[model samples]
Target: MQALEKRLKREVLQNGKVEILASSSWCVPVQSIDVTYQPVKRLKMDLLMKMTLLTFQQAEIANADELSELLLVEELFIQDLLRNLTGTGLIEKGEMYYHLTSKGMMQLENGIYEEEQEQETQQLLYSACHEVFLPVDIDQMDEYDELPDLFRYASEEPDGSLTFVEEELIEVLQNSREPEEEGEEQTVITEILSKETQQINDIPCLEFILYDRDKDLLFARVWNTLLSQWDDKLEKQLVEKEVVKWREYYLKA
Candidate 1:
């Protein structure tokens, strides 16, 4: 505390152009959220699809109706299934026959299919004061006991929206996530379903009120303990430009 005060006095206010009027410990609000997402899953093929693909593997069916009678399956069902297989590029449908394509041959051997489902949830964070999402690991945060209450940033409800930075979310999701082994199916978060707020928390910070002696004005500079640096953006947006409103807040405080 003494070292910081002396440094601030020497480097920041040595010219006497600005004065450090007050300083206090601040609690910056943060919201913890569970983001539910639907990932692209690679699953084993169903029995029906396996049977259908196997049929194509054997030989092309000249007429599904005739084959259906011998196979004890409905004719219309076989036709629809063949059309679906063609749609998925697993089989090639000729004008009067069906055959397996190269891709279909691989699927027949692997017996794996791609699907998009199975909701997975991950915990993440949001900086309410900055109105942005963060990929910060919560376990690494350095917390402190209650202290001098200077200011407490208000918390915001996490809406069911994926409006945050896409890269940040991707980084968070990809961290510590990987395929277990070679030839293993990799799960990717292709769609974010929802973000539900689970808890509201606060990160402690050092907030200082600076008085501009020349202009007879007041502003704030906030130090983010988590990042161990000054929050210039929050200072600029929250208190720097709005001198009038923040001055009023200071007086009220």
Candidate 2:
């Protein structure tokens, strides 16, 4: 990864933008590029996985909707993540709810979750690289002056077209929008917020995009969105799951 980063920095010096074509196995043919990899924020997969485990620990029986709200991630993402966890025997799904498996509990307790998470991270990275041009925009930096991370996940439409949505990128664009003439700014904001939601298999998702203004580079991180729009019943369910404990705890306050 460090080698790739160095190569990308060199390429950025000569080109305003560079395109990355990753093989299905997530391998980038270095000979095909003036650079091998572009700079990006490190993936947060570990944090996300740990958070998911913690959520299950907190709520004994929870669905993707509940987990989405708890994690502030898109429902579709939660569902996909759950599926991956299930494959590792870290989680199990029955009907529409999910529970941590005994193996999962043991891994968390023994700090083995980190190792498992690393393996999963590698898989996700390879998946994101397959046959996609991950474009990184080189003219803008996120609010933190940091480049956004990249991941591979997309929703397929009925017509067979792929859609990628990035809530974080959208949020960054919205927050960083320059103030315009009164009504003009409002219009821009509205347009930004009105970005159509994308989904896969009817599951909500977003595409990832990374930008590095310092290097004048941009790339698409195509991934599922972390914005789940669940119904009120789901929220109520989460409340009920911990309402008694919440009440008892807050009552003293």
Candidate 3:
């Protein structure tokens, strides 16, 4: 009994919630039927796991400070567990923090019935991605710019093909090329870009370009028009990895 107590105590220290689930009365049985019953009788143990994970997920929602306080684990430990959970699609890591993955959140909600909390978490994540692509006036930047060259320069000018460039080089060139007359009145160009008119002639395409601006030649263009702004080869790799992750998350037993 002393040996078993030490073992259980060690396990409880390793997983804080284990102590909460362990019932004192369960005893090892000599019969196979008793052992079978023991396995089936672990519903509370499963519940404890759900509650512990839900608590950690809630801490993530509340913020990093709360997470640190509530989880009682070292920062490094939390980071490792979160990384593993994200790799297994049990969590999602964003620019600033982490959240439960779709399946994780769904399981938590179904297991806990905390609908409002789950919806709030989902909205927060969705809004973060949504704001990234929303129409914003680029002219709002100090640099006064235009897209006439982009449209005129396009190899095949589609009606809505005047592309937007977020590359700093193109932005600098546009700003520096200004005819002193604009006098920092750049927002006009921004207002035009903000319209997102989308008509063949009126709507301009936008690309968030990033590269070494010092190069004299514009031989390579990184267009942000695709679902992910990456070259074909890089995009293929990303797609394959995403597919593999999806398979692991949904198709694996």
Better of 2 and 3 by lDDT: 2
Which parts of model 2 have CA positions greater than 4 angstroms off? 1-45, 114-253
**Residue 6 error for model 1, in Å?**
7.4
User: What's the residue-level lDDT of 217 in candidate 1?
Assistant: 76
- What tens digits encode model 1's per-residue C-alpha lDDT throughout 1-253? 4454455456556657887867766667667777777777666788878887777668667777866865789888888876777777788767866788887888789888755556888888778677766647577677565534434445444444325655567656766366456554656676667766666666766666788868877877777666567788667765645668756765565
- How much lDDT does candidate 1 score? 0.68
Provide backbone clash counts, one per model. Answer: 0, 22, 8
The TM-score obtained by model 3 is 0.21
Tens-digit lDDT string for candidate 2 (1-253): 2343444345434544443322111211100111111111222236788778877877765577777887789989988988878886888877756777898888666544422221100001111223432222222211222223322222122322333344433433444435455431131211122223222112121221224456633333322212122123222433445446544543335
* Order by lDDT, highest first: 1, 2, 3
| Two-way TM-score contest, 1 vs 2, winner | 1
lDDT of 3 by residue, 149-248 (tens): 2332223433333334434222332343335453322221111112122322222222211112243111121222222232343223333444455445
Error of 3 at 177 (Å): 71
lDDT of 1 at 17: 85
Clashing pairs for predicted structure model 1, backbone only:
none
